[model samples]
Target: MTDALLVLNAGSSSVKFALYEAAQPGEPPLLAGQIERIGDDPRLATGGTSEPFGQSTDGHAALIGGLLAAIGDLAPGDVRIVGAGHRVVHGGARFDAPVPIGDAVIAELEALTPLAPQHQPHNLAGIAAVAAAYPDIPQVAAFDTAFHRSQSEIAERYALPRGYAEQGMIAYGFHGLSYASIAPRLPALLGPEARRVVVAHLGHGCSMAALLDGRSVATTMGFTALEGLPMGTRSGSIDPGLVLHLLSERGMDVDAVHRLLYDESGLLGLSGISGDMRDLLASDAPEARFAVDYFVDRCARAVGSLAVSLGGLDALVFTGGIGENAGEIREAVGARHAWLAIPPPLAIATDEEGVIAEATARLV
Candidate 1:
């Protein structure tokens, strides 16, 4: 039987997957797809073919089972899924690299859910589902925060107590997998001068990272994914004092504040229509225009700040959904930083699942 690697990125309401014919350096995945709109109108699409998954169960296990069965039916019988890799959103301070997933590892990862409540629980659920479905298969977790482990202590620290920082309450950037997936390509794209680069990963969740010689020197995200650029539904870097005001003066509790910031803010809250950039761009409403403008402004400011961290920027790259597809957004953000003399921002499609597959292949 032919060996293959399955990479899964489980989010709050979707599961994206890719299958790779065992690691061949510089090779691409054999197939990729996602099951989106789960719990509502679940649909599965693979290799550009879309269809209703038709699984009535909303549980993660059922969704994953359906996905695996579908994949099995698509691939030749001689092809075997030998291993799996998961895109775990948070590794806290414990995992600086992709590690094999086991019972002990799962427990440790579970403890990190509070650190990344929106993503970690769903990521863990994917791991559990894969374990139950293919118990003998080796599994590895490629942390979204692992690539930023190269950031300096000062860069990763918060101004709060040093004790809290030491206790894993410091800046642990997300989207590292996306960044890592593109870092190696930068040297070839921009030549050796690309040592100092800033990569803006803009999507439903967004962040910018400063790379010095292809290593993370600093990043915008801190302690959690909500501490960077305003995202689709996340407030990003809001003043902590405002949170206190909501609690003390507005009589909002912790849960209420969480919901407001995590779900009711960002482009959605700003536009009062939808969090999706495409939707906002299509609308003629003033609120939608303002939201789009705000996102561009915030992204431009992040590029400026990251340039300072890198001493200077030789190149700037835009990846992720909005980054790669939204030409107007890219043009606006790039125009704001024109004075920097950095090359026109290069838009590259990020392959996070492929990165996970490669990492898992090494471990297995």
Candidate 2:
């Protein structure tokens, strides 16, 4: 049997998976697909084939199990998954690079769920599911925050007391894997001018990172993924006083506030339609237009801030779903910062799964 590497990126309502030949480098996946709408009308698609997943259960375990089973039935008989890699959203201060996942590592990662409540649980769920499915296979975790470990003290710290920084309340940026994948490709695409780069990752969860010589100097996200640009459902950066008012004056509990900020806010709350940029772009509604406009405005503002963090801008890269495909949004953001005189923003398709697979391959 031929050895293969499996990479899983499990989200709140979906699980994306890819299988790559273990020895293959700089090649596309042998198979790739995703299981979407886990709790409601789950469906699986691979290689242009779509079908009902037929699983009664929901959540990470069920979705992952269904995906594995489907791959078993669909993949070539010679392809044997030898190892796995998982995209963990938060690594805190403990992990700076992809590490082999053991029981102790799992425990430490579980403790970090509070920092990335929306993503870390699902990420760990993927790791657990894969371990259960393939008992003997080695698994590695590639963190989304690992690449941002290069940020300077000032960039990582908040204005709060020094004690908070010691307690790990400092900024831990997300989308590091995406940024890492993009950073190396920048110089080849943009020449030496890629030295001072600002990469905007604008998908369901959006953030920007400033890279100096392919290393993170700063990022828009702070202690949590919610502390960045307005995302599909997240409220990005909000005022602490507003949260306090909700708790004291509006009778909102912690859970309610969390739900509002992480699930009901951002594009969804702004438009009162849908959080998807595709839907907003397709709609003629004025509210949808307003939400898109707001997102572009905020992204442009973030570019200006990141430019300052880098001292200047050489090239601005646009990745992720909205960044790569939403021409109007990129055009608007670019126009807003025409004074920067940076090269035209380059829209590069992010290869997060590929990055995860490569990280896992190194261990195997």
lDDT of 2 by residue, 164-241 (tens): 899999999999989989988988899985699999999888999999999999999989889979998899998899
- Number of the predicted model whose lDDT against the real structure is largest: 2
**10 residues in a row with least lDDT, candidate 2:** 54-63
lDDT of 2 at 95: 95
Q: Ten residues in a row with the worst lDDT in model 1?
A: 23-32
TM-score of each: 0.95, 0.96
Candidate 1 lDDT tens digits, 162-201: 8998788989898999999999999889999679999999
Instruction: Score candidate 1 by TM-score against the native.
Output: 0.95
Clashes of 1: 1
lDDT value for model 1: 0.87
Q: What local distance difference test score does each model get?
A: 0.87, 0.89
Per-candidate count of clashing residue pairs (backbone under 3 Å) = 1, 0
